[model samples]
Target: MKVVRSDWSRALLVCGKCSKKLDGGFGPKGRESLAKALRRHLGLEKGRRAAMGVIEVKCLGICPKRAVTVIDADDPHAWRLVDEGADLDAVVETLGLIRR
Candidate 1:
């Protein structure tokens, strides 16, 4: 089996479907997807070399009302539902993401 190395200390799974539904309800102008906004906020580069990973995933099955579902890899059992234009700092705090 092929193998690869990564510097990820943590990972996140953001719902692509929910982000699409919001029509860019996050970021500075509130026109960026959750994953993109988070990456920008954390100053993380693309690919596996970043301090952590924020991946846009398929539907998480819990389609919330005007909210995006997020799953922290460390605590998958407890998912997070973020509303439109929610605070990125709060998200980072809740997810316990430490910037590199």
Candidate 2:
């Protein structure tokens, strides 16, 4: 296996299936996926070199109504259910992410 390096201090996994269902339910125009919105909000570059990683992943299997599921890599035990257009700052805080 090839080893690579990243600047990530932590990782955030957003539910891609849920993001699809909501149809880009985040951001000012409400037309950006949570991952994209967050990345933009934090000024993060895509891929491994970013300060942190926000990856859209498959269904986490704990789908909630009108909400997307998220899991923080550092705290996998706690799953967060975020409603469409929820406050990004709050979400960032909940996920323990620092804004750049």
Candidate 3:
């Protein structure tokens, strides 16, 4: 097995189904998915090279209408539900994605 390394300090699992339902409810023109919005908001790159990884996955099963389900890998016990057009800064702070 080949060993791989990543710069990720935390992992965010955004529900794809929820994002799809909202149909790009985030970003300036309201035309970006939650994952993409967050990445841009935090100035993080895509994939494992980013400081924090934001990856979209299939339905998380706790589907919320007009909202997306997000799981913080560092703290999986609690899942976050972000409403459509929610503030990205607040989400980043809530998820502790900011490296201090």
Candidate 4:
């Protein structure tokens, strides 16, 4: 059996529709996607490495009115709809991806 193993680090799932609807509601001047903002805040690369993985996925089905749906791979049952201009540090910590 071929066993392929890699250091997964951490995982994040961002809603595509929500991100698109907001049109980059994160980052400086609110001109960055949720995934990008999280990535920058966590100092993670574009893939599953460095610090973790920030992946933009299709609509998670919740579709918040004015926020993006975010799901931590470790905990998918409960999703988080992050509002615009929210604190990145708080969000990161809440998601359990980063510490205080």
Top candidate (lDDT): 2
The sequence of per-residue lDDT tens digits that candidate 1 reaches over residues 13-80 is 99999999999789888889999999998999878998888999999999998889999999988999
Best by TM-score: 2
| Candidate 4, residue 65: how far the Cα is off, in Å | 1.4
lDDT of 4 by residue, 1-100 (tens): 8966545566778998898998889888997999888878876777543557788999988989779998888987888999976899889778877641
lDDT per residue (tens digit) for residues 1-97 in model 3: 9989999888999998899989889999988999999988888899878888899999999989899999999899999999999988888788877
Q: Give lDDT tens digits, candidate 2, residues 24-66.
A: 8999999899999999999999899998999999999988888
CA RMSD for every model? 1.0, 0.9, 1.5, 2.1
TM-score of 4: 0.86
TM-scores for the candidates: 0.94, 0.95, 0.93, 0.86
Q: Candidate 2: list runs displaced more than 4 Å.
A: none
Cα error, residue 33 of model 4, in Å, equals: 0.6
* lDDT against the true structure, each candidate: 0.91, 0.92, 0.90, 0.82
- How many Å off is the CA of 18 in candidate 1? 0.5
lDDT ranking of the models? 2, 1, 3, 4
Global Cα lDDT for candidate 4: 0.82
Query: Would you list the clashing residue pairs of candidate 4?
Result: none
